[model samples]
Target: MEFYSLLFLLLPFAALSGWWMAVRNQRKAHSLIFSRYQKEYLAALKYLVDDQPDKAIQIFTGLVEVDKDTIELHEALGNLFRQRGEVEKAIQIHQNLITKAPLQSGLRSQAIFSLAEDYMRAGLFDRAEALYLELLESGVYKVPSLTALIDIYERERDWTNAINFCQQLERATDKSLKTVEAHYYCELAQEVLNREDPTEAQKYLEQSILCDPNCLRALILSSELSMQMRDYAQAINMMQLVLGRDPSLFPLVKSNLRQCYLMLNTKSAYQSYLQSLLEISFTSPILIEITFELESSEGTESASNYLTDHLRKNPTLAGLSRLIELNTKLVQPAQKNDFQILSELIGSLSKDQPAYKCHNCGFTASYLHWQCPSCKRWNSVTPAVTK
Candidate 1:
């Protein structure tokens, strides 16, 4: 009986020893695999440092497996592919991540968002839109997904949908998007105007003004609508409201105001309005327009004299160019050639200069853009104050 008990204890110990040996061997194999993966990770980094992204991508794609442990690595590799403009590779990697059955909910959302970004970069906006909408429904990437959808709608010129997503985005975040929303309405108004539907366009412009009470574009559009309806007095009133709200927009409304006054047979009233603007500030374009009015009503010499006085007060290349033009008309036959040469030289210089510049990004353009094309900011592009 004693021998049998001792043997039984020995058997238990033997079983425990066998279990320990199996664990030890498994850990050793795991350590070797980890060390090998570590070496490949270092090699990938080295390739990246050498600016060889293709080789780095190859190594990283090989090193990273689609598991929860390697989720971040997979995302990193996918982003690398995207940065290198290897969008197909990025899509493939992210698509694989989403397809994995064991990926965590948060990680799967990340992969979907990344795939959507890849589609956007590839200009597959429809595909991107669908994915972003799905993410929106999931509520995992609410703000970012809404913003991406808004951008997609804007790119597609689907202003109605753009406005809808913009409103949702506003609710998702604390930031106010009223100005952007107003611009969307203005875009819709423009489309309506293009279709020769003035009444519907006016309704849209009215909504834009309701969105942003001080929307200069809406006010300008309203004035244009009035002019289209042949209500010159109402058009003048709308433009006056524009100047009252923001005098810096004088350049945009000056010609329209002049036409309204002309239709009302009120040239003197227009001159009086110009004089009032001069009292407030001396903008070169305003002064230049005044010179034209003066040349039409008064004589060329009088217009030249008036511009000379203003030029002395506020000298600008634009004002100087206008003065040269007036002098070109007034100079004597002997001095006409010299005046013409000077005018041409100034014209050449001014013609190449951009008329509008974005205060946000310093992007310059030849004509007015309510939104800066480079910065994509609304009401940021304004008349470049030439000097």
Candidate 2:
């Protein structure tokens, strides 16, 4: 039956019969032994509805006695209060459960974990850490305590501790964390980058790659560090590795690769890379780069032909703008101005378009980020193409 229908049906008889029926049901469920707990529960219910959670918690705690069979009920109530942001009441419930002696191993561990979560909710990280460490010592709630410790260490910017705990978690859980490990190394690499220690940063970047060969953040950092050391060949190799590992980053890293190859005077390799990049799924910026190279080496005719063929398929504002730019280059002096106006219009259209977007939350950004600004997820941002 629908809840509303039951409520309406019971409404007329509620005041007269509900209290008597409730008392009868309580007696039926528990006689002399549970009589005290039943009274406490009803009193707690009254305080709970009256917005006096403190008194409710106290009444509930006194009724638990020695046995821990009520652990589920306490846990349920604690979770409800915590979900309602009543951390104080939740903590009281869990703490009372913990104080009850000879609780089952699992139940005791669960109560302790719940208490730690309550402390975390109350912004008492020290208390939370103490409870979490105690949980670890018991080895009953190892995974949960380790996970909470990881979050705490990350929030506190203690990467070393975070790394150690993450490794411990890996060993305990037998779960692969190579991806997160790679990100941690990248974080260290970035820290050293800001500290003017590219040499140390390079080691962390290398470790990141060794941890996960497909880590794009590591590749980006390695390429940047290679640039600092004037290792253009290695810089180019890193960008190429990124392209193979994560094609979504090609738009972000391609120009840097172009610059690196140009610095090393490797036009043949640049042309080959640009050509491969042009036909990939992420193709617009790659096409633009290739068009520029073609215009420089093979003249405006070849570049215009390439763009014309591609634009017939994709027809982006960027592609059309490049076509106009190439056309104006091939135009006679008199007709050049007309084509130039068309080129200017396409440039204006392309100029104001957003270049990057967070895939997680659709947050637009002008530059790429290793982490999404809105959702805070790693590698969830991609290039937004102009049309």
Candidate 3:
């Protein structure tokens, strides 16, 4: 049933349950309980009609104290409160249920888990962590509790604990967390790099690749570390490894790669790498980067001719933008203004287009993100190929 409709039905059902208890005076012990339910049910109806379903759920959950049969109803009410962002109310209901002496062990565990979720939603990570850890020790909800613990550690930026718990989860479930483990190591590498500890950063980066041999971020970081240490040859080799792993991500290391080649005075070698990358992945950004490199080495006319010929085979708005830019640089004084206008227009068209997108959630980004921001999945965001 629909949400509002379901809630409306619950009010009547709760009232009927109370009425039935009141009628059967054969159980005198239930008299006070029935009266309490009736009072709370009316109050809940008032809150529901006031368009405050959260408050109404709070009232209904209290009816669980009067009617044992209302345990499921109270659980549903707590979940509804949680879904509505009434986390405190949800926590109250779950906590109250779990504390009740006569509650079933299974139901109490369920309440404990639900309360942990409530804490998580409310950003009370400490509370959530404690409850999840308790659940983990109990060994009832091992996977979910461990998963929650991992998330809490990640949000806390406690990578050591996160990595440990992730490994624990992997061993328990017999599932691979190689990708996530690799990102954790990469994160550690970045932290060390920021502290100017290149040697330590290199170790973490190596661990990242060891965790997942296909970790693109590991290669990129290794390249950056090599460059920082003034090892241009190693940097270039690391970048080449990046290209071999995923040619579509060339733009990420483009500027750095160019600097490394120039530092080593290997312009010809840089051109050869570009040529090989273009052959493997026909992308506009790669083509444009190569055209600019060629323009610096071979002159405007040569670069313009090469780009124009390449565009005929593999056309893209970004390519057209570069072609116009090259032509603008080569045009005579009288026609230069017109070519500049065309170049500006093409630039505008490609400016807002993202260069990468999350394959899982369709989240678009101008730069590479090893993990998708929207879905939080590792290595799901890929380079967006523009024709």
In terms of lDDT, the poorest run of 10 residues in model 2 is 1-10
Among these predictions, the greatest lDDT belongs to 3
The sequence of per-residue lDDT tens digits that candidate 1 reaches over residues 196-217 is 7898998899889889998988
TM-scores of the candidates in the order shown: 0.83, 0.71, 0.85
lDDT of 3 at 265: 89
Model 2, 86-132: lDDT tens per residue?
Answer: 88888888888888735556777888899999999998988998999
Stronger candidate by lDDT (1 vs 2): 1
Q: Clashing pairs in model 2?
A: none
Candidate numbers, best lDDT first, in rank order:
3, 1, 2
Query: How far is 185's C-alpha from truth in model 1 (Å)?
Result: 1.1
lDDT of 3 by residue, 1-387 (tens): 233343445454443334334334344454455455755766675676677876776676555563454455466667767887888888887888787625546667777898899999999999999999988888778999999999999888898889999999999899999889999999999998888799899889888889999888988999889888999999999999888867777878899999999999888888888988898878877888888889988999999899998889988898898888888877789999999888888888878888889999999998887778798888898877646
Q: Model 3 segments beyond 4 Å from truth?
A: 1-8, 11-68, 101-104
Instruction: State each model's C-alpha RMSD to the native.
Output: 11.7, 6.6, 5.0
Lowest lDDT 10-residue stretch of candidate 3: 15-24
